[model samples]
Target: MSEFERIGPEPARLLMEQGATVVDIRDPHSFANGHITGAQHLDNNTLTAFVAGADRDQPLIVCCYHGNSSQPAAAYLADQGFARVFSLDGGYELWRQQFPEQIAQPDPHK
Candidate 1:
């Protein structure tokens, strides 16, 4: 298993409040459905370009539907020199359950 710091919704919220950049790694379709507020949708496909322009100095919080995808994504960001990178413990699902107000609701028209 890969070593990762699993953060709960409260801590995640604090991180975001403190200027952490939340990166959602789910597919664009799923992202358009819903995601955390202010999260940047990079998806698995556009990671390279996203990282190129991303601020390495900023704290990065990565998330996915269940947390599986965000692990490697967070690791990749770390490898790319991001100072602080984290994966949401249980991904957006747990986040939604813990902080309903923070989760972005899906748009019906998509």
Candidate 2:
């Protein structure tokens, strides 16, 4: 059984460097405002497709506004067969504070 674990920003970054897939559970607006670089936004409507197409062998990291919502989402992803699942501790808020340069904002011209 795959199990999800809680991880802080630093370790999460390290995992990302090792090719982990990162998903943000925040709403579209918040996700557009700022998110971890390379993060894919996943909501109810998009989750099924994501799960179906995702590479289960790669590490998956789930993030929410404050690290609370990601826990369940991470667990759910793990159950779906992701080998290494992580609920980002402190979530996007903490990640933003700790690694501001890693944040990606929508293009103003768009």
Candidate 3:
């Protein structure tokens, strides 16, 4: 089984600059409220395609409410053949606190 890396918000930001695909695993309601600027919200419904269609070589960063949940999810993703996967340390809330500008505004239409 493959394992994922755990990284702090700052390192996660660096990976984004390096072209990581950030995926938020929080519920849709929470995700719609706020998320990383370039993140894509994902859940059970979207996970299959997201994994199957994803570029295995591309880096992936998983985020959740707190740092806890993302570890298992990231490990699962990596096990699914994702070569490089990471779970954000301190998760989205911490990210929002430390990097307000990086948090994306909610879409009014959603």
Candidate 4:
């Protein structure tokens, strides 16, 4: 029950088109498998930098395995002063199902 918004793929896409930063909070393995194109992988090690560097007024969309975790994460970002924050409604699983073209793997050769 966070104050942050939960958005479906289309809305998320619109935000992306307008330059929202996409952050995937999934594990490295999950992230490596596939994620929204251009998403920044955020884990413990990179989180501090993410927090410091993320623009306070810029929109952000946070995604997790099933959409539950991202809600809290998104709220936290908003509390941290990120002006516009959103949680991917169905998470990456649903996004991949609905937007195969927007999915990306870091390196196919890896």
**Which candidate has the top score in lDDT?**
2
TM-score of every candidate: 0.87, 0.96, 0.94, 0.93
Candidate 3 clashes between residue pairs 3 or more apart in a chain or in different chains: none
lDDT of 1 by residue, 31-109 (tens): 8777899998986577788888888888889998888888887887888888888988889898888887887877666
Ranking by lDDT: 2, 3, 4, 1
Hey, what RMSD does candidate 2 come out at? Answer: 1.1
Best by TM-score: 2
Query: Per-residue lDDT for 6-102 in model 2, tens only?
Result: 9999999999999999999999999999999999999999999999999999999999999999998998898898889999999999999999999
For candidate 4, what is the lDDT?
0.90
Tell me how candidate 1 scores on lDDT.
Answer: 0.84
**TM-score rank order:** 2, 3, 4, 1
Candidate lDDT values, in order: 0.84, 0.95, 0.93, 0.90
34-91: candidate 4 lDDT, tens digit per residue: 8999999988899889999878788899999889999989988888788889999899
Instruction: Judge candidate 3 at residue 68 and give its lDDT.
Output: 93
- The candidate with the higher lDDT, 3 or 4, is 3
